[model samples]
Target: MTFSFEQPPDKLTWYHLGPLLDAEAGRLKYNPEQYTVHGVSNNAVACCWAGLLVDGDGGLVLTDLGRSMLASWKASPVGQRWLAEQAALDEEMSDPAAPSLPAPQPEPQRADQLGLFGAAS
Candidate 1:
């Protein structure tokens, strides 16, 4: 979660917005009149940019670039482990195999759960 930047003495600090554009899709809409150079320095500027993609209901629908970034992250080892842990938790919550639970109890159903033919009853 931490990144270290090492620079030799007397080196000028340079930062670029190119990576931000890549990480967040160019779909980030900015108001030309309201957005000044000074506003770019604010931390909320990033959130403001991302807010453009949000629907009226306040839900974010990912664009192709965002989906690609998510796919790339899911392919990484850490992301894979995180995804696996989430799946395990979901499975445990839905279909608890613990002996303590009473018999004949039905497993909880999720809309997205996949089965051989359809969702298990």
Candidate 2:
């Protein structure tokens, strides 16, 4: 019925966009962009316009609607799938043991007969 900063959420809103997110964006912070989970980007401004967040003492805090949306997202099966996938992606991205992307190849500097130029010079 009530939300408290001290209590952990049912599902962390901050990490993988789930785990890390819960620790980062889910809490009240000194930064001004906590509401949108990122700094003053389009989504940040849009969230304010959408009434999902508002200016608080030091930064943006979630409005009632925002909290409800987060609650619903966490409760849904899609959210679970997305969270799991995101967590895996994050792990893969950071894992030194995971395969690294192929090194970029040098591109041709000149245009071809078809007038197509290489993606990079």
| Top lDDT model | 2
Best prediction by TM-score: 2
Q: What is the TM-score of each candidate against the true structure?
A: 0.37, 0.54
For candidate 2, the 10 contiguous residues with the lowest summed lDDT are 15-24
Q: Model 2, 44-104: lDDT tens per residue?
A: 4445555555656554567676667676786789888887998999988999988888988
Residue range 14-92, candidate 1, lDDT tens digits: 1212323333544434334555763233322332343312221222233343345456666778668876997988888
lDDT of each: 0.40, 0.54
Worst 10 residues of 1 by lDDT: 7-16
Off by over 4 Å in 1: 1-53, 56-58, 99-121
